[model samples]
Target: MSDAVQSVTIVEVGPRDGFQSVGPFIPTPHKIALIGRLHAAGLRRMETTSFVSPSALPQMADAAEIVAATDRLAGLDAQVLVPTARHAERAFAAGATHLSAVLSVSERHNMGNVRRTPMESVADYAQMVAMMPAGAAMRLNLATAFDCPHVGRIGADAVLALLDPLVAATADVEIALCDTTGRADPAQVRALFAAARDRFPEVRGWAFHGHDTYGLGAANVLAAWDVGIRVFDASVAGLGGCPFAPGATGNVATEDLVWMFDHMGVASGIDLDRLVDAARAVAELPGAQIGGRVRDALAARARKAAA
Candidate 1:
């Protein structure tokens, strides 16, 4: 870890990203309660839900209700993913303080996932950013920033090119490099973050969304952390996968990351025990399986101590 990088922000995406991949639907109240528990655990940032069409992503059909029911932490910032302007409108109306949008660097994945070419999606994102409410913040997630499952081996230049228009637009936006298929390595993560930092100096915040497909998620995270990137995306109990990307798995686990940060002496302001309990509760939900080693290990330790 860099001496200059003292603390990192962990954005919990389990409620939205993690839960959406599971087959059966989680109840709206359950989702809200889960988020509430996360907030109580000292998590100040979370991705609550995605504002997508119900017919397309039935899992997220209750997005509006979840947002409305989630209790806002005093200083917490909540974000909702939006694929289009209409999604943004609904998300903003539903009381989301932050809006997240995605544009894949791979043309094929962009078209396949969002039904628009990469270029078209970029233009659409720019339009949405411009139309955002005055006080609302926005972030652009560059999905498949590393290797694309469909197109394979997306170059750093290609990733930077996609960011060009967004940079020029001069909107208040942050960029998160997403390992959509969980295929990124340490070298790829370093190179991408270095390239993004060099290209877009105005981009205030840098985040990484890594998948555990190859079990390189934590290693890649360490690589980014060494390079001054702080904000990271993780899911509770490791719940989530990309429906479009076959063989993909949930993101890096929130409890695992919190444990790592605690051991590293990095301040995350999150209570690991509370987060672990929340993860266990989430795991018990239908269609959700627990996925973090720390949570499981801690549970074992508790049982042994009791015995």
Candidate 2:
């Protein structure tokens, strides 16, 4: 790895994506507390919430309240996921400094998840990016970039083709390739990142959003890292699953990823002990279950040391 890749940015998506997957609504205060704990655990970048219709995702109905509650976290950059221009407006009003727009690479998955074709979603994203407040930054999350549950395998060329307009529109636009269905392999991950690096070299940053459905999220992360890709999207305690993607699992656990990076001599700037404690707290929430191996291992080690 080059000196330029000395550090990686871990975007904590637990409070939003993680909690959203846990079904039964988590109280607004509990969500706020989780974000607070994550901030205290050395996470600076976080996807705080999404401003989509509550009718669609009742779990995130408290988007406004969640954003308000997290206003006190000094030095934390809170981002909100927006599906449309209207959602972006709502997020801006709710005090979000960063906004992320999503478009799936697979047409079938895009229609299933966002109710639009991939092309239509990209058009919407371009419009949203154009209308974004000059002060706020916009990112595009290319969901199902690897392999789509509904559409089988997706080629790296297809992924780049979808990103063409977004890349041409904005030089610094960041794109996150989401393994929404967690079906991506290390080889696929390597190919996708390499394609992005080679084709869309102007892209500001490349992010990986992997799910543990196949239990290779961290391995894929390692593969991407070898090719100069940094900035990952992880949920605390492995919280998150796509309702549209059957048999999908939660994201790469933030605690588990941090532990992997720390042990591998890679720097993520996250405190594993504090992150594990946060994961335990999240696990105690109603309908929430802890989903990371490192968290469990750390707990066992701590108990043994105490004994």
Candidate 3:
């Protein structure tokens, strides 16, 4: 607990990561409506959609439409995930102002997720930088930076090695270390983030993306926050999991993090009540694999109050 740190940025990924794993096709308008609710709750940054192959992720087939709607949101940093160079190009064409490019540090996972070695993905990212429009931002999501499904645990050296070329290739890009399998412990999370900060002092923006499979999501986030990390990727209602990572569960819930930070006397600039309302709605979606405790607990409390 660094008492000096007071605020954090929560990048809502419910519309993208949360919806991608759902079996039922969420109507495009409904997706946009959820995004609207999130924005109203003061989520200034959001991963609104991904520009992947429509055949691969039919859920994201309407990426352009999602961006078109989110772009109008005042002060919203609407991020679109682009898994490949071709997808990155499509994102730019769709007028995406912020792009998230993900590459798994684990070779096996990278190959399975994007069919490319880590270095090859770095090469593609270099090209993505060349194609970046003026004033637009890019984030490098180092998936499985801490733990991988195929491989048990990834070493800090492996994560640093991958960052070497990635940081060299692009300047001023936010790098997020993702716990794709949600198996990383707090000690591991703290150590990796500390090493990364020391190794790459030039990379100003660092983010933590964690899942709650083993229920360490908020604890790991606290560890990272102790190490000075302020940006985090979380889904509303904990509505996300790596589709490529088996046995992995949903992301740490946005409302859970927000509630934790609020109780800790930290600011996230989000309205917890409104955010819970949004999460409650998302949790009701048919066949959706939702997770998180705060939403249901708060709902129960409200019910008790009414009773």
Winner by lDDT = 3
Model 3 pairs in collision: none
Model 2 residue runs over 4 Å out of place are 1-5, 242-248
Off by over 4 Å in 1: 1-5, 242-248
**Colliding pairs, model 1:** none
TM-score of 1: 0.94
Q: Would you estimate the TM-scores of all the predictions? A: 0.94, 0.95, 0.96
- Tens digit of lDDT per residue, candidate 1, span 1-307? 4543478799999988888887898888778888989999989889988999999889999988877776345676888899887788888888886889987888888888889988888788877877887788888888989989887877999898888887776535788999988878999899889988987888778899988776787888999998889899999988885555555556889999999988898889999999998999888888764465788899889999999
Q: How many collisions per candidate?
A: 0, 1, 0
True-structure Cα RMSD, model 2: 1.9
- Candidate 2's residue-wise lDDT over 126-174, tens digit each? 7787777778887788888888877788898898888887787786777
Which candidate, 2 or 3, has the higher lDDT?
A: 3
Top candidate (TM-score): 3
**All candidates' lDDT scores?**
0.84, 0.83, 0.90
lDDT of 2: 0.83
Judge candidate 1 against the unseen true structure and give its global Cα lDDT, from 0 to 1. Answer: 0.84
| Shift in Å, residue 114, candidate 1 | 1.3
